[model samples]
Target chain A: MSNLFFVDKISTENIQSIENEEAHHAIKVLRLSVGELVYVSDGHGKWISGPISEISKKSLAIRIENTGETHAEKPELVVVQAFTKSDRNKEMLELVTVSGADRIIPWSSQRSISKWQSDSREKWMITVKEACKQSKRFRVPIVNNQMSTNEILNEVKTGFAIVFHESAKEKFSEISLPANLDRIYLIVGPEGGITEEELQLFSTINATVVRLGAPILRSAHAGFAAMSALQTKIGRW
Target chain B: MSNLFFVDKISTENIQSIENEEAHHAIKVLRLSVGELVYVSDGHGKWISGPISEISKKSLAIRIENTGETHAEKPELVVVQAFTKSDRNKEMLELVTVSGADRIIPWSSQRSISKWQSDSREKWMITVKEACKQSKRFRVPIVNNQMSTNEILNEVKTGFAIVFHESAKEKFSEISLPANLDRIYLIVGPEGGITEEELQLFSTINATVVRLGAPILRSAHAGFAAMSALQTKIGRW
Candidate 1:
């Protein structure tokens, strides 16, 4: 496969215009000239196959040849992670994107150290988009606004829900995954872990409490590990 | 659990002397004083419960109150990873230790960007030790000197072996683990992935070729996922 670049929008006609930023990247950073073959994804599941027609300092034009469908519309696995400190939260977002999580909900648990502000939601979206581009993912995962534990639990009632805790007895491997399961909601606590009331709420709601392992993994690492394992178990990965 | 530190050498007596770098860490970094409680490990499965008895600029003395029996011996899990660039290789080592692998062996594959040098072996050992400490592991995973792919295959004669490849037909979860299997060897290729010859060699030797999922993961991330799955499959975690 050749290098794929993501563009915000593109047309199917012979002459297609590239976004200003993408044009600068192709002409200045990648140094592509006229008639060079390149691929661009519109983040809407369409892969535009074309060649560079005009390379200007501000914008580049491409002649489209064919279009291909490159994505699926399946309901995605969303992780509702309790907010940690800045460093760990950033790492958690990176890991979740790389591990192919569909959405991330910054949650405020009883033990959360950091609180999410409405102003910072856009910044978090930018970070997640960058990670998606780096990982070559066609569809960027959604970043939801911060929610309280009760709000998240309410959302979990609509899908397959699982919570990761240290004291859980059921190994993840032994859990029976539903065959027609489409959307999965994973809840991870902060570094200090979930409070007893939170666990009780999950238990009362019949959420599957699973254990990854005995050696306690950091919050960021545990998110990735659990996502990878769940994907493998569900035959998605 | 409280913070635990590993010392290189410790006498089997009730009185223990901390010197050199550890002493500096206890005295300056953590700011522990006399009669304070601390946990120390010898990095050989032995953990000591002790309290500081004396303090000085260069030395801190501890009086051991109790010695617990060693935790269960680590199940042998060896990681054969192809050499990556410096920063990525370091992250790979950190994840390997955090995932509870017992040993790491660097491999030089056809697509490897980094070449192993004799002088860098010591630095790799230090990285592993630091990762072990940061992950709260009592024993540091052994870092073997660099070896060729052929050499590793020759040495791994009888134990269960698995290779992670994107095109493999079998999923890792489909493999039936041995009842008494104590050792497992996982081989992961570099970012460019393994060559056809290496795959052929593994196939000829009946090594299980497994795929993690449909989505392609970076090489460094593959080993950690495989180890996590294996640990769960064997009921070791």
Candidate 2:
């Protein structure tokens, strides 16, 4: 796997310098000597790769040999993940990020045992970015502000959404998904599960309630399972 | 969700006692009280559910109200996972177990960074059992002894298998899967990836090489992604 560093922008210049923490990571941690190949991404769609030209105290310069842009796939896959306990935060983010979630919404459901911390967003951003580099994904997922159940319902009203429940009669494979929609939302609840009133509210908007199978996945694992199934169903995988 | 404890066997007797470690877990860790509804499974489909009748220092008694058996789903979903580093052992097992893997095979691929420990099987079994309890799965996944590349080749020759590779031209959703298979083997390589010789070796046995998507998944996560896609593709999810 290629070691990828993030930059604010990627230009078409023949030469560039990588500074700050990423430079330290490249020089000290990864131990990349001069003339070693490396990749740099803007964490959107643009990326450039080249050989290291110089190693300096403050930064490392690279000679650009290739540049490309990754076109975002259509019918984005968005995951509305409820806050899990602190121990599972990294696991949850890694699973969804590698499973190709285009967007993520932090949800605070009625049954959620964990409350969002003051630095929750910052911590989540760091984890998501690391996952992007590991998965070789140039298009980083957009993480939104925490949402309440009512806010989630309002968001689902304008788009197609599927809520995974253990008691749902319909399986995810048995449901019909729209082909023309710009995005599909996958909703997962907390460890204690979703509330009955919240289910009724989602039903009012005609959002589909479905089960993945017999196994009851954790709140963290459910989003990844749904995304994988949806991506394959829509012929993306 | 009801707390589930594993027993060697679930009898038709009106009352049964849960002793040893399971009893400790319920009485101490979970702090389950008398008259609380709980479930006990034989770990091979047979299960009983009832309310606790009494709690003792060495045992807890439950009055059986209902007993049932889960028929094994046809065309078992088996994961052939290459050994991952120690840090990822729990994450790897949890993902596959929650994703509905019927069996798990440990593979020692050429590029595997971690060597199988003497007590690896015992540790894996413990983790898998805990995952089963959390996922509400009655039939526990079978964990086999570590197998070499040649042994895995022999196993693949006798069953239908799909090897997940990043450079494969075929997407998982684009392939034609047989409907009558008794089992489908999903093979995942190590973090460093499968070697060219091993790919050829699997190819000789007519194993299908497929890619999940553009994103490169970690070895710990690929099995879960493949299992989720396969389960939904076959209408099991």
Candidates' TM-scores?
0.87, 0.97
Docking class of 2: high
- Candidate 1 lDDT over B143-178, as tens digits, reads 888888788788565678889998898888787867
Candidate RMSDs in Å, in order, are: 3.2, 1.4
**Candidate 2 — which pairs collide?**
none
lDDT of 1 by residue, A53-105 (tens): 88777887778886777566455699988888877766678778777888888
For each candidate, the DockQ is: 0.42, 0.87
Best by TM-score: 2
Best by DockQ: 2
- Cα deviation of B10 in candidate 1 (Å)? 6.4
What lDDT score belongs to each candidate, Candidate 1 first?
Answer: 0.78, 0.90
